[model samples]
Target: MHVPDWLDAARQRELLEACRRWARPPAGLRTVRTPGGGTMTARQVCLGWHWYPYAYARTVADGDGAPVKPFPAWLGELGRRAVTDALGPEAAREAAYDIALINFYDADARMGLHRDADEKSAAPVVSLSLGDTCVFRFGNTETRTRPWTDVELRSGDLFVFGGPSRFAYHGVPRVHAGTAPGDELGLTGRLNVTLRVSGLPGPAPGGGRSGPRA
Candidate 1:
């Protein structure tokens, strides 16, 4: 479901600013290379759990190998509120959003049809969009082909999918360049922040465990 203008101007500004900081150095924004040799046009950064082509890790094993930035509590709270607004209070109260994947899309960037199956949890995925609008295709789990809905997601839009739709196939087919929110937001391309639960064991205090390989 799409909740248009779910985030007010002030909230949008705040998140955008936070994203700028999160996109810098160490565990910062970087291109994602698929195992197949092609690279994703959109650059991304992960929090809580680092994401590679097909799995999640505690560190960016594919990048600088630094530990990922911790997921902010404030962002988790915001996600809970979003779940309550989009799903219900029960889901909001139960959501344990510990991971965030922030994808940056330029004009020519597009995500292929895919399902977010790396997460072990069955919880819903909450996506918050900022900057330019894009055609977000929501498809079925069985295949990447037809019977999908193309939703035009603009800045401040919130989309939450759970239940049967939780594992559905989805992707961004196109982004309308130069359509970012006014300069006051300080965002150029599109920024997509998706919050999820890792469902994996948490690291012991002082880092007692290593993430399993893919």
Candidate 2:
């Protein structure tokens, strides 16, 4: 489901500012390297659970090995509202979401076709967009090739995929450069924040990592 302009301008600006803070330190934004030995152009940072090739961890085991950041309470609240809005009150009632994967995209950054299959939870994945617009390629569960839909995702848009489409393949194939109201938001790129339920056993590492910038 795609809910256009779900965040409004004020919320977009606020989330962008929060992204800046999360992009620093030991567990800060870093490039993702796939198991096949290729690096993703879009840099990413995670809260509650750090993700690697195809697994989740409490530390940036693929980058700095620092303890992952905490899943902020405010984010949890926001996610609840999002899920409630997307899947109704009943679905949101039992949702205890605790993982967020935030990605920062430059003009040239593009995510290839892929599927989000690391989570054990069947709950929906809530996605929020900020900054520049992009062509989101939402594909099928059977393959990365065609029979897919290309949706233009702009700033403040909310996209939720779950139920039958929960494990479907999806990606950002192109980010229209400079399309963002950069002068107003002070961001020249794109930011995609996805809230998910990890459903992993054990709590995240109780420690935090802070120090020199990444």
Candidate 3:
């Protein structure tokens, strides 16, 4: 479901500023290379647990050796509230969300159809959109093809998918360029922050390889 205008102007400004800070250094936003060797157009930063091509680690395994930024408690609270608003109080009480993937999209950026299968938990995923609007394709679990729904996600919208839709395939086909929420917000692109529960037994042992920046 999509909840439009879920966050007021002040809240949007606050989160946008926070995102700018989170997009720096160590675990900051960077283009991601898939296992296929191609790079994603949208830059991403992970909190709580760092996400590489196919695994989750405590540190930026593919970038600097520094630990990923800690997930803010307030963000978790926001996620809870979002879930409660989209689903119900029972879900909010049961969800122990611990991970967040923040993706920034420029005018030409787009995401391919994919599933959030890396997570071990069956908890619902809460997605919050800020800035430019986008055509979000929600597909079935079996494939990335047809029989999907296209939803236009505008700034301050909240979308929660769980239960039967937890493992469904989804992607951003396109982002409306130059459609940000005005200059007052100090943003020029789209910011999508998705909250999930990693449900990992524990953080991976031994630090990741210290590699050059991607």
Candidate 4:
């Protein structure tokens, strides 16, 4: 579990721009209320298919009603590059990182401690943070007890967890207001995108995850 401080500003800007485009409604971004009665905006660009914003499985129809944003292959490559850079190119090839869950955090946003256990793949989750700073709470998989680590995450920081760290309970306790890069960055709020590969039975195709099994 290591946080890379070498992610230069230019790279950060590149990812930020990509997120802004992905955050566009229809193309990917959509707002929904959380189980706790809070709200969260999600951008599902890739990772094959997913029932984003919703925790259930359903078929998503595409029509004039709601435009669906196709997942960009380039972003998949970007995720690969991130893994290769952090865990070496060879390891990156073996890593499964296809779906990215871009979450927008408001001033009052907070994520309770939980494990990313939905996906069957054991590959590490590559999380990128842009705009604003927040305290990340990392806990163990066995229990939400002691041995928890709270770390500060700022813009352009990359957090990767694999091997023994995968399946660990982690979340954002809070997001500091007015911490984003501003208008120039095209990002007005905090953006956290987590790239993952969903290892469903068959090869998952593009389109909304709310659809019948192919």
lDDT for model 4, on a 0 to 1 scale? 0.65
- Minimal lDDT window, size 10, model 2: 205-214
**For residues 127-159, what per-residue lDDT tens digits would candidate 3 score against the true structure?**
989999999999999998888999999998999
Give a tens-digit lDDT track for model 4, residues 1-214: 4565535667677776766766555545555555677654322343345444433232333212343344456656666777777777775776645566777787877777878877778877888888888888999989877689998888877787777888999988888777766664555557787877666565444534322111
lDDT of each: 0.87, 0.86, 0.86, 0.65
* Number of the top TM-score candidate: 1
Local accuracy of candidate 1 as per-residue lDDT tens digits, 35-126: 99999998999988999989988888889999888887777777888889999987777688888899999999999999989988888899
Cα RMSD of all models vs. native, in order, equals: 5.5, 4.2, 6.0, 6.0
TM-score of 1: 0.93
What is the lDDT, from 0 to 100, of the residue 31 in candidate 1?
94
In angstroms, give how far residue 183 of model 4 lies from its true place.
Answer: 6.4
**Clashing pairs in model 3?**
none
* Deviating ranges (above 4 Å) for candidate 1: 203-214
Q: Write the per-residue lDDT of candidate 2 for residues 36-55, one digit (tens) a residue.
A: 99999999999999988899
Candidate 1 residue 95 Cα shift, in angstroms, is 1.0
Better of 3 and 4 by TM-score: 3
What's the TM-score of each model vs. the native? 0.93, 0.93, 0.93, 0.78
Instruction: Flag clash pairs in model 2.
Output: none
The deviation in Å at residue 38 for candidate 2 is: 1.0
What shift in Å separates residue 52 of candidate 3 from its native position after superposition? Answer: 1.1
